[model samples]
Target: MSSKILTCSVLSALATAFLLDWYHKKFEVTTPPTKNTPRKPRKYDDSLIREQLSRNYSFLGEEGLGKIRNTFVVVVGCGGVGSNCIISLIRSGISHIRIVDFDQVSLSSLNRHAVAQLEDVGTPKVECLKKHILRIAPWVTVETHNELFDINNAQPLLMDGNPDYIVDCIDNIDTKVDLLSFCCERNLKVVSSMGAACKSDPTRINVGDISCTEEDSLARSVRRRLKKRGVLKKIPVVFSSEKPAPGKASLLPLPDEEYEKGKVGELSALQNFRVRILPVLGTMPAMFGLALATYILCDIADYPMEPIVGKSRTKVDGIIQSLAGQQSRLGNTEQRIPIPNNDIIYIVEEIFRGKSPISNYSTRLTLSQWDPAKKLSLQNIVVMTKEEQKLHEQRVLKGGEKLESVYPPEVIQLVEKRFAEEKFYSQFR
Candidate 1:
């Protein structure tokens, strides 16, 4: 009985002590304020950035470095020009970067792309760019938008963080114009690239306002379009004043027996059409990219590059201007020219317009020169399309005639369809 009474007393005492401790913590009173202490700014050491970009410090100083770090740069395409631009920016201590591209690295891209490799084939360009940037400037904060920069996404992609510098290296004209228009409308700083293909002179490349640029086919096209939108001047561009040598204009081989698979890749995103493969000298894009980078960097440092202004009429610019003028005069003029009903005519039209008028095929046609003996035309495709396969089986059931094994099913179907459609449309006419 005595032991039980002692145990109860000890439990009561312990429970009371626990309740007192809980009350003290839960409703504890705080000390009154002693108010006048200033908060210390967090310490930062830029030793790595300082060391890496030490060479630039002599020219730009810490002020330039600060601006570069604070600046958010956006590179639109991750091709030869863009890849180099991103790298130059990163090397110059521009840490905040965003890349926008939708293309996968093709085996052909390695010739000019500074960051692309054999292993990078089939990888998205923006993803590959991020990896490459991280390899060199690991401290950089890179954001990638693995998408095409179109009007729909341009606002979101560019304005999300309010980029400081936008680089235009896109291959497509419409997209380029859209990006440039957006920048111009918002008064954003941007530098664009012109035709770097077929250009070999690194010394001739320069940077200037789009209005002041000369000798570049791309710059001329862009200028004409921007003028239509009332964007007359102040858009910066990197261009080459060197003219492509006289005979070098026709760089692509004739679509003879050899180049039947003409311009295999590279299709237009907007029109869904194939463009001719312009000859690209490997180093030319790199040179243009470096020039573009220099312009942007110098612009950031409050310094301007010594851009070459053309005094005489440039051969390339003169040709482009004449073509533009001719385009206006050719509007709805019924100047009939004799067109031979031959395979070559069809192939030539398709080559220039990016699609065959008869078949409406937007991709590259696997076409060869017509053999007069075989009685074939360029419209006579070699491969069996799905519709042709069905028609071939149906025609075989009629048992009228057996086609030669060498003749493709598509050719037979095309002939029948063309005749049938023509007869129907002609009856109405």
Candidate 2:
């Protein structure tokens, strides 16, 4: 009726709008959903650091407790092997701790401070180990620096908590060789603690790699001062191969009004060679601080750990080549300087003691010999033989021990030609 039914209903409404746009582009339609889209939240944490490290879930599960809750340990000595290696690294779940030390809590550090007490003697061992690690991981983050870690604040307290391991337990061997050369020049990750003072076996404790330490004489003087500071890498410690024993407790030398009522500093002969009366047996620094928190939580739970076993096969260059062919009966050189001038035989017996023409005997035979081109010169008329001035006034009353030094003119020209003989100045002049 209208141009053939309106061109056949406009070709059936343009083939029903091209079959509904090809059935909505080949079937796919439900669209209503978009209000900040997100649906992935399978996380839960009933933290007590996961219920007291929930028995480290059959050996560190949950990806080793999520890498021990993002690792960061620092512990440079809090005392007694860094307070039992920070109490087995905060009860073995360490969730970021720092704890450097200035030291306090003394009354002789309660035998081997494991978070010491006696009302925490004088406190500040990083505030009693950060209040005993917040009474055991109060969602741990301990930190505390409390000064005295040396080398100008040890590289900003070891990269301001950038640590992933650094339990050195600092007992000052030049601040543990400047914090092991500042963590081997930024390669970081450290572990050190040699010489747990006059050790008491614990089966000769040991770990390794300060060049494979042996017979631990403080790891052979910290491996000869880290090989004179070039720092031959390999550092990793926890040493003790017996050999310290033998101390019968003798720090004697008191009486200055009983050593000023229990000494308060002023004993320096390098602090009496580091205050030794040496008996220490608080279970060998709590078993070398729980074997250095079991080598920092078993190398952060990758766990295979087994290197240190009965150390001391003894080859520190075969004990320094058995102390190099043993020759040192006081004769290395300097024309035979074996140290025995006795004030140039008491100034050549007061220029030949009592009587005999001498007038300082040619400046005392040019002060007994060894002028290896120049240096040993003794001749201020030093003659003392009334029992050598009564044994030098009882060795300056037993304290001023500086038994005079500089002597090397062929060891005082053999005690000045065996006491300037002419029948020994005619029998003591």
| Tens-digit lDDT track of model 2 for 201-228 | 5765778787765556666776788778
State, as a TM-score between 0 and 1, how close model 1 is to the true structure. 0.59
Model 2 — TM-score against the truth?
A: 0.26
Candidate 1, residue 320: CA error in Å?
Answer: 27
Off by over 4 Å in 1: 1-45, 249-274, 311-429
Best by lDDT: 1
Candidate models: Cα lDDT each: 0.66, 0.61
lDDT of 1 by residue, 53-170 (tens): 8998878877876787678898998889999888999899787888888889999889999888889999888878776776676677778777678889878777877889999998
lDDT of 1 at 6: 100
Q: Candidates' TM-scores?
A: 0.59, 0.26
RMSD of 2: 24.9
| Least well predicted 10-residue stretch by lDDT in candidate 1 | 32-41
